[model samples]
Target: MEQGRAQNESAELGGNGHDFRPCQSVNFTVHRVGKQGTKLQELDTPRGLACSDTSCFVVDSGNKRIKVYGRRGVMSGLFSSCQTFSVSNSYWDFPTSWSPQDVAVDSSSADGDHVVYVTDLKEKVVRKFSHSGVYCGVFSDQMLRSPSNIAVDPLNGAVIVTDRESRQVALCKPDGGLIRRFTVPGVPRGVTVSPKTHNILVTVEGVSQPAVYTPEGQAIGESQEHENDVLDHKAADLGDLCVDEEGNIIVADRRNSRILLFDPQRQFVGTLLSRKDGLRDPCGVDLLCDGVVVSDLEQHCLFYVRPGVANTSITKPSQ
Candidate 1:
């Protein structure tokens, strides 16, 4: 991965060793993949993003497939709908077509292998896949209307799906049994499970702020205002979101064409990437060990960004 230089911008924070003073902007090194073609590295309307320790998964929505990339941004593999039919299944009950909108990876298995869960908007079900892209089975057909996005709980391997038509988030077992469902204010777009606190983070359509919920469906918190910002800190169009191990929330603000950072308390930190960084309608994001992988719809590509705090010592104050 080629390293890019960090662009400096001023930001303020309160307490937690991040005082309300002008500190150096967050640093980032970006690596991107894909172009306007049908190659393995090319993408079409890439939407949902999820990352395991070794690979990042992209929901190539327009292509009706999922593309996998290694940590260094190399194209690894891809998988599309399976057409195998069961003898016991009726003609109409067989898998005909699929439109995948989002994907999630479960890497908490005891055997060290990861499992993939993909939400099919056309089928209204979540399909399971092995780590290397083997079709396992489909689940949640009876519970979802139009499944848009999905996530896996690291603690228990529960699959959480956001049903757009139902305006609900359904938590299901790995085997596809429904555990419970909760209603959100608007059409839920993105859903993810936090590894640190085990809380669920969800983004709703037309809602400027992301909402936090407990695993048991209790409302907890939403994005809060930043003290120093004169403009509204809320996102214009929110998309997929993921929480790092430290509980820091990374959100894809689509309309704003940028990626936002929020503390564990959902307080706005700052813009990590924006239009200046070549983003045009970023729709999905997932965290890597040292950075994040983002899917841009308009750009039709994926970006791996490693973020860092700028060094205040070398930064010159604006005069």
Candidate 2:
């Protein structure tokens, strides 16, 4: 295994003479095996991933379908092919075709159900489906044109989507009724609900900063320290983001080929995943209590990284 840059434990100090930020070094191992190879379970241009307690869902964008991989055991690691399934139909009730762009898991239904919400760029809607590959319905609205990314509010089961062409974020009820839409300061790319404050966090194109909004579509504030000012056409740009259990926002920094870590207050902590850590154009990220699973667009496969455990051995890629 290759050694990465040694961590700076005393970095990121505040006036109080203490460092509150998480370490910048990656403390996890990497696992590359997924439903690929000669077995015919090839993933084409995987762009999104979402995780639950027992499984990880991948949006095989180019293939126009979602792939579900079940967790084998506590120590079995991520994206095991032993128990897996795929969803191609638009909804469980209808056999319509779909071109999925991103995906999110909503388990906050009134009765506590786990429903998978995927953004269909072709249909311009967020499609709801059960965990077992049963499509429920579409969160349709006339204003939703070119739905790019989605995030589900675990507190209220509301679905939030970033409409790139419209330059706005739409908040909708679980049944697909529009609550309200907030205009993004710039073109919105990725959006996620902060688990700590339940606030809507959005990453805009050509802007290094992220905007924070309330669930009611009210502006809270924008992050100050995350300003990278990278051009939209630049090689290194922002990708999809997700909130970890600790309420920190994990961002996929594409061109940089790494994952960025920020706290609830939107303060930059450090780099979580990077090229030195074996990530290349990692576009989609999802967290687990023990680790994270990311979708590599260039590699066309899912990888598992165990954060917080330094010098962990890298797993060999599957045959």
lDDT tens readout by residue for model 2, 1-319? 2323423221221111111233444344566645333233667788888876667778877656677777565345554553223344432222347788898888666664688889988888888888777768787648699898898888888888899998999998888998899898778888988766788888887655567888877888754434554322334366788775446677788877877666666665566567776678787887643555778888787767553344433332232
Candidate 2 residue runs with Cα over 4 Å from true position = 1-26, 35-41, 81-97, 110-112, 224-226, 229-236, 307-319
lDDT of 1 by residue, 1-319 (tens): 4355433333322211122222344455566777654455578788897877657778777766777765432222122222211111221122237888889999889997888888887878888888777778899588889888899998999999998888999999999999999998888988988887889999887765679999998989555323334225443577899876667777788877877777677766667677777878898888654456789898788777654344322222122
- Candidate 2 matches the true fold with a TM-score of 0.81
Highest lDDT among the candidates is held by which one?
Answer: 1
| lDDT (CA) per prediction | 0.71, 0.68
Q: In candidate 1, list every pair of residues with a backbone clash.
A: none
Error of 1 at 283 (Å): 0.9
Worst 10 residues of 2 by lDDT: 10-19
